[model samples]
Target: MAATEHLLRQGSFPAFFGIVAIATLVIRYLYPDLFSQSPISKLPYVGTHVGLPIQKKISFMTNARKLLRDGYRKFHIYRTETALGQCVFLSRDSMVELLKKPDEVINFEKVVIKDFECKLTKLASSEPIVPHTIRSDLTPGLVRIIPRVAIEVARTIDNELPATDSWTAHNIYDKLLRIVAISAGSAFLGPESCHSEEWIQSAVGYTIDVVTGAVILKLFPSFLRPLAAKFVPAIKRVDRHRAGISRMMVPIIRERKEKANTPGYEKPDDMLQWMLDKAPEYGIENDEEMAYVQLGVGLVSIHSTTSTATQALYDLAARPEYFQPLRDEIAKALQESGGDFTKDSLYSCKLLDSFMKESQRMSPISMVIGKRILEEDVQLSNGVFLPKGTLVASPAEAVGNDPAHFENPDEFDGYRFYRLRQKGGLQGNLNQMVTANKQNLAFGYGKHACPGRFFAVAEIKLIVAHILLNYDIELADKSVGRYPNKFHGDACTPDTSKQLLFRKRLSGQSEI
Candidate 1:
């Protein structure tokens, strides 16, 4: 009461309210939720959170997996500091209940906005149009573009890799990145744009730049980030790429618009065309907005597909015994589909699908899944309460490796899912690369599960099928098996620096 009287005597009511308003804004920026009001604050915290907040944040940034694993072991639900803010990590049992909640209560887009700094980077809007394009058009159009995707993948491989009888070591990650960029680009930007070096670089560069810029901007104080973003090299590069992409895209968009009603006009079946068709419905008005959406699509698709494909390749090379079987399966599937690599042929290659799924299972993308930021209060089935503004996720990596769910989970069984599929029940449907369930959260789970995954999985299969049919791959260092994945915080990515030896096969396997 004395302190309250002292504060009142210090300034006018307007001044006091102004100071309180500024403090409220600052606290909201620093903390994801109100420390005194949030239910998460009542839960056990994984790391120190009271004092030394910066140190806690640094520890969380560097040792996220360790902290997460510790939290998973110790608590049913726990709070942990992140680079962004505090997040609540849930146990495996609670994931189903959390995932079942509607977007209005536990929102996915809100989490993405906070995590990706979408508003600052100008990479995405709260309600993005790309997901609609991917689900409604891109995935459906795969049947028409499988042949084109095959051609692009083949061309990229031939151009980037040597077709020599003798083994040549190459950075397989870089090679696959290029292959995915061009192939995925063909769908996102059309064939002509994919051919341009400037566009490909911009597409690839934008993803890198945005990530780099986000990381750099995150290091600054929230109030200073706007100023920091203006001077950061990576942030500047992102703008250049964005402007260049808009310049290149505007003309093509205009041309397509002009030719829309021509008597003999044939609209291209690609993401750009599909996106343009859906843009108006999503409040995307100008060419610049269209370009941003296209780049946003590229950002998610290219890097993820490339990393998954690279990981699969590393696994295939490490365990060479699976190669011939995958090759034979691809050959059989292609022959069954009348000598063309179509949707049917890709789907028919069950062993390949299993192998990809297993590769993903062993080295899943991130440690957590079903990331959400609650917009309204949520109560899990277990009666755990999450207040509005709470960030939440499940321990995905632990769940994937749990022996209770997977038999001999530690062993990297390439045919794990294939054998499950052979059981001829619900397991068959659940064990695919693209299936995102409680068990498989590599692509996340529920309504927010990656919409572009079907196309991504198809592209990955196509690239791997082509590689198996045309080349022999092995680790450059014969003693080293699969290169270990590199981790930064909760994220896991293929070792980009590792090289794999590739040589052309003695006899050309038929084109997949």
Candidate 2:
């Protein structure tokens, strides 16, 4: 790491080239996860670094679709080294085997936090995370929450979007971030204060700052990241935003304290209250602990929902043929639910659901998925042996686009999965946006698959339904059809900086 940093700091073209070439050869090749961790496999050793040119680094950083596709096609089990560490990129079968291992064997929970330890440096956890109440409690009440979420989405759309068909070019990603944060905030932070501009900014800004700090820290090896980035500007930015959130939550926390043992008090039915309720026993050791719960939910929920919605919206913009069909589906669904975004309405949105899933298939938010760090060295179900501490990930993008897995994999067929769902009788399973299988690893594939996915699916669909019903969308530049989403290491998020043109459609619905 020191040598890599030295080569990077020199600023000489030769030294820079040497860093890529040699690192690719040594750290990535000669010392891949397998070779370094005693990976006993007979299959071909396919890696991103092998045969990769120094010049492609820039292209690879932003778009590794080609690289991942080739690697997965060539090897059933391969190792891909990342900035944080090397992870063996498993095939579908191997991933299933990896997933079956108990958390005791391949503990994703521990390694996942460690992967970002330098950034979310103060998260309080040493045991398996006490599952967020969103699952056991809120999810059952999601049918009830849907209307409130719809209300928030409607409010955000009014604030962020222009009046009906004004025909404006806007950075949709930026606005979507606000939309999801504010909308999800309504549920997570409670109705009393979730609408505050300062609170919303802090929620969104804290998430961005955490990612910024993590990204900067990723440049250095794990050992050095703490010392180097712990007090850096990016981390300090996270601290500042967190402090802002703390200031806002203090009154609520105090009020909760006052009512703690009062005979007439009734517990609030929301995440903020849940976090506060669990804080004393879980980790609300301080004000910072209280803020961490809210920010953590926002980080995963808002960021991921925004990315998925942005990509789907971009796909809709590029393919105008999809617009009316999707809108019609939403309209029909709303009518079925008596003009509401209810759970029944969500189920009725089969086409819109298909659109979201198809868009994710075409442009995944992450290049890899099911990343698990081995805690107990064991032979996989597929006869591949992974030693302890190996970071294992499946080439999710490649697998999703594989010819064996998906027919006409490269083409953007919006209803492809919907048709498949009908023909194959998969309606009860894999076709849904929230379902995660070996074929659809976006939400992941196992016991620890994202718990927030159901909420995400519901949230995304509501936002899209509102937009399609209210506006006609197209690319700001007609030539910018299906431009690939940007990549940052293994994480792929929508290029929110791009512009999309929208005109208010005076269709039956005005906003909601």
Candidate 3:
């Protein structure tokens, strides 16, 4: 009788508590505002809905000028969701102020690149060398050898284009990939290694896989991302591709080291040799490890060059009338250099430079300029204060398209900057036309500006010049009025699906 009484008392206690719990839940659901004030509101479920309004608001302002005829110069916007997200979109004056203080306010190497190195590749084992190393290593080499490298690569591509002429339809992306891969590989690595089929394919495939995977990984929440990344098939693909590249590179590096030690061996004039010489400065001694660094350069050079080249070609094919003037310019430059693609000759093609600059202005790689995160509390000239870890950005698209800066910003004017240079205005100012200011933001600016740009520009010009001189090109779909456009968050990409028609031009007619 005593045991039965004890059991009945325990059962009553649980029942009593269950009723109270149910009552609390019912009241909370009925009045969401009561629960909204609590820290639980930020716990994923509630945060998603809370963030929707801010996301929608930002999307509207970003696309406003493009869709609307309003002459809005700048817009101030703020997003609040447990954490404060504040940014000012400046068009005319403020854009210049923000870009001018890139070192003090903009820690691009630490901010824009931190997430990539720490979260993606874990290359932060050493000091992060983004814009710095890129500047030092690429500038000198590019200025000296890029034109020569481009000529060699272009010759290889020109040989391949004749075969494509017989085909009814061809994929321009695939062809561009081949051209860029060969050119970039030959420039970065020695010609012997670049010519190998295995090396070219592995380098190109691994770069695309790793870069694309890294981008996807950046989109997830920190806590859940590691778990998701492990299971992602794209990550696996990148890993596999990297391993293949390593396997090929290891043997090649060993052979090069042996040759270097041999007496009276002539040194190669390629980026691989340059990187090998500089490896000791970075504390990289092992031949295999140094080869990996070379591989990284190949990845950066090939992808960026290929994407830009393909876009330029697609633009040329879409507008056939623009072809003759560009061809004439290239021909005159080549003729001036005794019919050779020399470094000085490449620079002489002012029209080619302008055309490429126009292509980048119309379709930039990203919509934001100098993306950074504050390391500590910072105040901008516009009176906006950014807290630690807050992501900051400038309006690249709006600034590029602003009518106050460029006349008729929407239409593609190939001779715009070239004409400006002809009038004895500062050519250095035109360089800013491609920077992260009120004009354009293709390669970024200041200490963090893309170091590989000089080489990239030279390579693109050489390839295009060679293609124009050797081949007669047209769009497979002649009716296609404009290149397809792609938007990812704030970035824009040219249509990769378009095809180009290529036929070998007669030797004398190439000049026309």
Candidate 4:
């Protein structure tokens, strides 16, 4: 009995358990897709020395472009395995077919919901309500929305930017972010709540928290997200932001609902009211749900607009020569419209539009727009078989930089597309940034393309018009063109910390 007790106390049981555990982990790490028969299962992997797990992390962090380009060169549609699962890379030509499939076949919401673990985080839902609200009211009502957008742009620029005739250096991305938050909040949440400093803070927090959470959650495999989600600080912050937003919005919604119950009460035609109108049917009526849905709209409108504007400003600052030409155009447009922003006035600045387009073309936010996870086994137009759970994205930068599409694709010719517009041909409309097609996927292409693009265009142009008309801006380092976007695997965003110097326009320079 004494001898048996000594043997047990030596930790033989623990040793056996530990060995089994280690063996299980090794197999799991080595063969993440062992159960799947997808082409990804058989494809030659990236790195053998460091193993698949460590190699994927290093290459993705250090040189994603080289890794991506190497794979793209070898196979037009090749697969790479990661801790997060296999992601398939396709060339520009595959986009036409990839986009043609219905939502049922190639589900986008599922991908977002899966990658971001939206179900666990509840930061952004996979519902059709936001899209429906956008398609039905927001885009169609751009002309009406433009005035609201312009007013907010004017107010925000004045309030957020430094005052007259003095040069002040600022983080342009941060400035644009705050400006977009205020303006987007005004457009999205309505006038009363948008002005509340607390609400603006929460709104901005929501965008940061949700995106950061999504990115962090995506670092793990799909199955591990739920368990890993709790450890991610950003994911937890999303819940806190949601709670804050609810405190602000609950009363407004309750009052709106109560008022609608009153006889002859007219409901406001704002985004909140729109969501409320769809609530009962969509089953997203709670204050928390309402706040999240609207924040999702913020997700679409704020960052994209702010990022594009920031980089565009950087581009303009880098080339200060465009400042006068652009200002002159805005001055003429303002005078033509009697010192007001209208549809005709905004679009009339063709050069300004072209500049914005070129900046976006040069600095796109992602390598693939409208990326999706395959819900079922599917075949592409090129006869490649993509199995269920396959991740795919069509080429964005490749198409934008292709010489076959644009003249001097590598150069930043502010007036290149505008010149093409002046010569107005069948492809001239394609030159416009908002015109989404096979070639230009900045706003995406096909039925699922962004619905809020019209509002984005008007809002961006108005803000730029206001700035160009009021201030003289310059790059901090005129020698360096602009800072490269921060890249994370397939994602890209402007470095928000980059600063710029802006001074008020000299007195007597008001052409309007």
Cα lDDT listed for each candidate: 0.82, 0.75, 0.62, 0.76
For model 1, what is the C-alpha lDDT against the true structure? 0.82
lDDT of 2 by residue, 1-512 (tens): 78767776886669778768876676664434445436444345444444333323334555556666777888757754455454577888888877887888877666657666633555433422235577765678798888998999988897899765468988999999889988888888777677877678887887777767766765655688768765668688877777787778777777887897899889777777776776767644676566656666776678788989999999888888887788778877777777778988888778888888999988788878877788878787667777887788788888887888888898988888778677655654678888877768888877768777888899999898888888888788777567567777677778777888877785646433
Best by lDDT: 1
CA RMSD (A), model 1 = 5.2
Model 3 regions more than 4 Å off? 1-105, 109-137, 142-144, 163-168, 218-220, 427-438, 506-509
lDDT of 4 by residue, 425-510 (tens): 76577777788887678888878788878778888898888888788888765565777678776666787777888787876355
Least accurate 10 contiguous residues by lDDT in model 1: 29-38
All predictions: root-mean-square deviation over Cα?
5.2, 7.2, 7.2, 5.6
Choose 1 or 4, whichever is better by TM-score: 1
Residue 107, model 2, lDDT:
71
Residue-by-residue lDDT tens digits, candidate 1, 118-153: 767877745467787788887888889888888888
Please state the error at residue 36 of candidate 4 in Å: 8.2
Name the regions of candidate 1 deviating beyond 4 angstroms. 1-37, 48-51, 508-512
Question: For candidate 4, which ten residues in a row score worst on lDDT?
Answer: 43-52
When 1 and 2 are scored with lDDT, the better candidate is: 1
